[model samples]
Target: MTSPPLSDLTVVKRAGRIAAVQASVALALVLLVVGGVVFAVYLRAQNRQIGAELRTLAMTADDANDPPPDMELALRENNGHISTSDGGEPGVPLLTGATGFSDIHANGREYRTLVVDRPEGRVVAMTDLAPYHAGRNRLLMALGFAELAGILASIAVVVLLSRRSVRPLANALALQRRFVADASHELRAPLTVLHTRAQMLAHRVGTADVRTLQKDADALVADTRALGDIVDDLLASATMAARKQARDRVDLSAVAMSVRDSMASYAHSIGVTVNLECESADGTAGFDVIGSAAALRRALTALVDNALGHVHHGGTVELRVRRDGAKVTATVADDGVGIDPDAMATLFTRFSHGAEHTTREGREPYGIGLALVREIADAHGGDIAVASKPGEGATFTLTLPAAPPA
Candidate 1:
């Protein structure tokens, strides 16, 4: 069974795989951060350990009987001697050479300090917080490395998982492109034959028996032209998708009115009415801003033509044109039996005309709106969108961004 174009799971799946790249990037960044924090903790712990060793050595030096002037604190503290014993004097200094110590308590751990006195009455002290510092650092290093491992593992898993999405999407896109190329190719041969046959039979229009043949030939030519146009539209859309077209300044309002005029005539011939409301403004010399009179007219005409298809007699087809910023917008609306909400999701996909009256299945498809509208809009650096409900009317809006400011 053929699926609708817009929401093809294949495209979404490809898109989804591409999206996984971000997940990979995120995982790598997380690992980097975790690793950095872990390394930082290691350095901090090493610094604390060095401080502790220095203090211990200072205590050892104080034990020496005769020490250098700077080493006097280490000698005095090493001997554990003081002029007065503990509690002998309230204000008596315990060590001869040392400064005060700084201590802190954290996370169920106590950090202690020690002071030593030098012969010069200077004191030196070192905190015994090395154990607490070392333990926390070891914890961070372990956890941080674990985090990095998990991130790498996650990336491996994602790459494997995302392939499921990639293969199917690539297959589907290849299938659709091949189908379009084949169908368009096949139709061209028959259409060329029909066109040639019509021209050859043109002289027989007055003959009684040949008159019918001539009429049929003419009809064949007309139908073939339409078929050729459809093929052209499909090819154009593919071309635009493959290679970007340049953009230029386009006057949207004038274009809208012109297309409206054309559609109005077509409507009259088909016993319907079209209403046009267009407002023009002078704006920019922007980039990729293709709003020339002819192109905008074509875009508007495609929309009007699309609206006319599903529209009922006495129903109105309306068009409105407005300029915004550096870009322009044209909206075409119709009062008719609208589209199914579920179907709108794929409403603008290629080869998406209905299965009745137009295709080999004899269904009345609203033909080629997606292909032509997309081509026209895309060529002008713009886009088209549809809004519809089952019983309510449908609206197709075209939006083109203005050129970049010079």
Candidate 2:
């Protein structure tokens, strides 16, 4: 619709006072230039005609016979007026002074005395510039109107397109909000029922189905706990994503060690070992920090679980805590099927492959654990990084801000 053809058609209705002014200016310039050229050509032609007339008089004077009666020296003159006739002529001979010339312009016309012979008389010619100027004014008026019309159409199109893009975004966001609300409601009851049944089986003793019930109870507890962890992680992610950098006075060093101690019994059952280390500089004790404790522990546990699953018999899992000035660092490393450098790039991305994918043989890594760790780091205004070489070992680091002044 904004094409040149369309804009020109739209001009008659759209163009206004400004277009009219532009057309007037263009017309003025065209008239001035044409007038100058026409005037110059007229002067040149008149000069040539005057010279030819003079040559004809000179030839008449040189002829053997006497000059014509009209050419007699007894010419009548008084204050440059010639009222008398020549010799026996019926009327006075027309001199260059008696004839006048005219010039034409678009709106008006001009006249002037023309005397070609300065020594005797002067002659002049007319410059007809009116027709060309009229044509120029009409052409400029049309183009000025077209330019004004194009600008208005472009503005209308931009407003329409903005409305088109905004509507779909508003609808998609509303749908996602509705979907999450409905799904969370559906998940609550089944999980609570499963948790209660497992506890009941743990208490029942000498009941008719006690033997079978005991094994069922243990499996139910493990799976239910795993499911609970996944749900909690998801909730935490949503919360932290919404509320960035929730900081308080949290003892990071104690949190790391406590988490390791809590998992001791579980590691022992799986033939795994744990070692915890702490190093605090002056003005530091347990490496307290202004950070998110729940998020930090969640991140630590995910890395620990990954480490414990990979380490072999007698192979150790180390949790180290330390601080340097404003920085607090914690590391979890294990001697296992070391991660490949290529996979390290996506190691913390959601659903990425890891050492757990291959080391456990039967059970593949579900993949969100490390992803959560990185998310927590980002939320706390920190970061998580990993370094590994195949056949050697792997180390993961979590770096956070030290506690701030109250």
| CA lDDT of each prediction against the hidden true structure | 0.61, 0.60
Q: Write the per-residue lDDT of candidate 2 for residues 191-309, one digit (tens) a residue.
A: 67576776677576566486778677766766666666657756665565667565678888879988899877767767778889889776454587777788788888888888877
Q: Per-residue lDDT tens digits of candidate 1, residues 1-406?
A: 9966764655677577676778888887877787778777777776676466647645554333443321222223234544322212211232442355544343443433345454543233323345656776777778777876887787878788787757767776777777666566656666676767676566666664766786677567556656665666556555555564445555566566667776676687666688977554654332235445554565677678767776777788888776666666778888876776766666776656532121122112424556667777766667888888766778988888865554
* Candidate 1 CA-lDDT value: 0.61
TM-score of each: 0.47, 0.51
Name the Cα RMSD for model 2.
15.5
Compared with the true structure, the alpha-carbon lDDT of candidate 2 equals 0.60
Candidate 2: worst-modelled 10 consecutive residues by lDDT: 83-92
Q: In terms of TM-score, how similar is model 1 to the real structure?
A: 0.47
Candidate 2 backbone collisions, by pair: 114-122, 114-123, 115-122, 115-123, 116-122, 116-123
Report how far residue 317 has shifted in candidate 1, in Å: 1.6
Q: Residue 378 of candidate 2: its Cα lDDT? A: 76
